[model samples]
Target chain A: MAEKAKILIIGAGKCGRALVELFSKIEKITIIGVVDFNQDAPGIKLAKTLNIPTAVDYREFMNKAGLNCIFNSTGKAQIEEELMLSKPAGVEVIGGCSVNLIQELIKEREKVEQQLKGLAQRRNNVVGNIDAGSTPIIPKMEPPDFNKQVKKDEDFWGKDKLIESIIQNSAVATFVINSQHKVLYWNVACEELTGTKAKDLLGTSGHWKAFYSHQRPCVADIVIDNSFVDLDKFYKVYRGSTLIPNGLHAEDWYSKLGGKDRYIVFDAAPIYDTEGKLIAAIETLQDITERKKAEDELKKAYTRLKEMQNQVIQAEKLNTIGQLASGVAHEVRNPLGIILQGVNYLENKIPAKEGDVFETLTMLKDSVKRADKIINTLLDFSRFTNLDLRPEDINSILESSLSLVRIKFESSNIDIIPEIKKDVPKVLADRNKLEQVFVNIFLNAIQAMPEGGNITIRSYGKKLEGIENGTSRREEGYFMIGEKVVVVEIEDTGVGIPEENLKKVFEPFFTTKGLTGGVGLGLSVTKNIIHMHRGIIYAESRFGHGAKVTVILKIAE
Target chain B: MDRKRILVIDDEENFTKLIKWNLEKTGKYEIRVENSGLLGFSATKEFKPHLILLDILMPDMDGSEVAFQLKCDEDTKDIPIVFLTAVAKKEEVEANSGVIGGHPFIAKPVELEQLIDVIERNAY
Candidate 1:
């Protein structure tokens, strides 16, 4: 406001327009000449209306126009040229529109001009505008802790102040946890690394019990089978689990806090105390909820693709087998037809005589029967067989099984005392297979009691130990379990299975009766049948006392 | 009426022997057993058998081809051919309604009476 003269302006963009606006509104200062290459410039016209002279050529105005201070509104690109032209000629180009807008631009230019006067350095103040509530900021200096004197400082507040100094002063996030893995120290950097503030995370257990059922093989995917895995190794969780399956590195673990699903990524490192004790683990939990979701989606897509590939392969195999069936059908049918024709002719020739013709006819018929059996078996195996389950009475099956063993039982003098439980619950089973199982178990029981012993069959929910389905084992759990299942028990008074061998009896190809030339398919088929019905069978044995087998079935009601 | 003659066409020697044994021993007709389709096609013209029992599956020319060639010829066209295949299901035999100019088939490993009955029915 003190020194007034002609101020030259250049460039007619937003910056140029702003300068014209601000300077035009000012009263004393005269914008003597507005110059730009664009002859039809709006600012130039405004300058014309203001009664100031306008020129495209700076050289033309240099002689005619008198200026005290120059404001170069041209731009950064043209600033150096403008300054070189004006500054050597003893002009102050002070006010101009710039990138550093608001009041900082004005102060910065002042500092630049002061440097020419050999003024002392001036720091950039926290500036906006004074009326706009701007304030200058400057921090107080503290004495440096150079000597080792503070190392043994006795004051708790002094130590706290020291630790707080390190936390705020250093760029890294840090924490000092106790031996119990309780978080004691949390820094500002830690809060920034995780969106969680220090207050939310402090004094809480940093050891998270993670439960993920997905087990998808990507990401920093760790499977926690037990309550905990040895957290001895540190993993860099570049990617984490999310709602949407990530194709690669998609970890899907469950959260124990109300069994919610939380997606997080982390960089885990072992934490040690000042005394060098392996106390806790320090980890940064990055809220990768969005990234985890994207990852989970990708992982799910990969799994579905793999499943589709396997299905296609299986379908192709079935197609090839279907093609082969044609040739097989013709080959089988031809021989079958010939046998039929031969059998018909022999029946006509023999006329029921006990001779070569009759014997040959009978053999021919039997051969055809055997061939039919093979074809039927093949058809059954190839066809998808659904269960035709019904509520089959177990005692009826047992009785039929005993009828099959009746002749042998009497001949072998293996006495059987039937102590079958009356009013046993009927099980949902395929009648044929259940009968097969009954015959097998009955025969086994009869064989075990070769020298005549009594068999006790009981149906009760009794104690079974150390098994997941042993609901009846616990005192509080047994009575409530009757609503879930009914147990069938069969105990034989014979030389039982050995302590070491009880578990193997139900497995296929495991039979101790080697002398009887057992094919060992019975128990395996029995076990398969029982499993198909969604039941469980287990055995308890003592070498001399005898073996007791218990089967548990879900009650129909 | 002239006695019937049957030409048994089979690749296997033992099968031919057994058929020849059973048929020729009965003295019911003049029987000739040819071991191959090539030999049987020629024998059909020379033997001039009233009926031909042709085995369908063979190494060289199959029975279907021999039947085809026979029905194509003027001299052997008059003879009735019955395909005797080891692998002719009921549907397969039923499907081959008229294999060679209304000629029928009796499935193979044929019994003594059935073969005799087919011969008797087709006998000229």
Candidate 2:
């Protein structure tokens, strides 16, 4: 009997439990104890059932009698280092990954020894039959290249055991096929990934069962066939194919294997014999589903970041325009003031009896007045700060603002229609500034309906879902999903805004009315004031029909 | 018994001339114009005006600086100053009886009647 090796296991985890199961079955090794900080670990519970001793610390067994090995399964390098530094002489420390490797090697050695014993027994039976003058017919089972001189491929793969083990243990799924599409090499990793055993697939041409339900040419089959034109007929819609050194690479989405879709990348290369004859083709597959998912998410995030960047740039441009307008308005007003006074002086000095002279002065005076109005509007649009906020009724503000323009609208033969929803919520806003915003919009509606049409003022309060698509501009500056808001829609039945001009309606100095007194600042100033109130205002129109201007405001808490 | 004497100081020549002509046209006052603040300050001593109409933005010295200097001087300290500016809001000027900053400040391009009303209210 061999000398029994006494060993201790450290860190009772899954790995430790596995080691215990393997070491317990071995005849030459005896487990002294299993140690773990967690007393209730799965491995510790399993060791207890086997009557093995358990401890919270393994240092107590450092100098134990007859201990030959200490297996450190902790996976922590520091703990393994400390154990190695303190191990007693004559004891071996098999730690970390090598512990599992040693366990596998021991099982392999046992299997090989059993096979040798069976071969020896068969040889004895054959010799006895020969003595009786009886020849038994046995199938020839020999490794390839038994009669031929060492071929290049046989010398490289068959003779080299290290390369054979490397191919068997490769992490990426790989398989080799002959010209007949027969699988010659199916790695262990490939079996684990496809849930097919290598023993069943080897020497068989049914390798397509791993990826597809029906018979189809895999990448390795195409390499063996060497029919490049058939690639498009078989895999017509691959992502792309690249020519690598002595290989072709392609990636595509595969779903025939009854599971979640997988984006697999595969490379195929032809293996040639020493005389340059094609012997086999090998194909390697790598699952890139997670990496592709992360890349798509990053692309979406980058797109959102770019959109925010554009909005910031637009806001900066608006700010610059506001500053420039303020400077220009101030400079123009002084000269305009002087011109107005001069015109007034001339009007007084010149006699009214001189027809053209007095009329021309009146026209000049009117032009100066018009210029002054434009400058004032420009100044108003730029100076949107120091807002006075208070909780005020939207209905009352609409009513008062309408009253300011009611007389003008009535004189132009345009009917005024007020549709105020009762019990509307109050909004936090500057009462005077909000009034100015309503007044400007009302005046615009009135101007749009110059040919005697009805001006409808609709007011209501409700919770608005996020702004609808197609009108993204209204929600760009300010709005949250599921916001409580009060809406005032001022619709006019007149020549509506053109589709092309609808986007430009809120822009400064963009007006459809030519020669008419549409300074174009009415909607622009209204937008500025509403923006200051943290509200939204937008216009919807049909070219030949009428236009509707909607204003949305947040409800005060 | 004598007419009200006024001194108008502004950088705009045409504007001051129009104000002088408009005020003198009323036949209730005699007005003198000066384009520069320093020149206008000296004219105050020689003209001995009852009231001063000053422009806020001037070349050499602004209206506030001139007002500070006049207030410091013994002879000119009693003279009331009205600011004529383009920056003042028309409605604000009208709401406060045409007076701004405790003194009358009229928005420029004022109507003749409105300007006379502001002058009468502050000149005394």
Please report the candidate that would top DockQ against the real structure.
2
TM-score of 1: 0.36
Candidate 2: true interface contacts recovered: 0.34
Docking class of 2: acceptable
Q: Which stretches of candidate 2 lie over 4 Å from their true place?
A: A1-318, A385-392, A407-414, A425-428, A446-454, A463-485, A493-504, A509-519, A540-546, A554-557, B73-78, B95-99
**Which ranges of candidate 1 are over 4 A from the true structure?**
A1-194, A199-262, A265-365, A368-557, B1-3, B24-30, B87-103, B113-124
DockQ of 1: 0.12
Each candidate's fnat, listed in order, reads: 0.20, 0.34
> TM-score of candidate 2 restricted to chain B?
0.92
Model 2 lDDT per residue over A8-96, tens place: 99988877888888788866678999999998987799899999999998888888898877888888888887886688876766675
Over the stretch A183-210, how does candidate 1's per-residue lDDT look in tens digits? 5556675555443465764666442322
Deviation from truth (RMSD, Å), model 2 = 20.4
TM-score of chain B of each: 0.87, 0.92
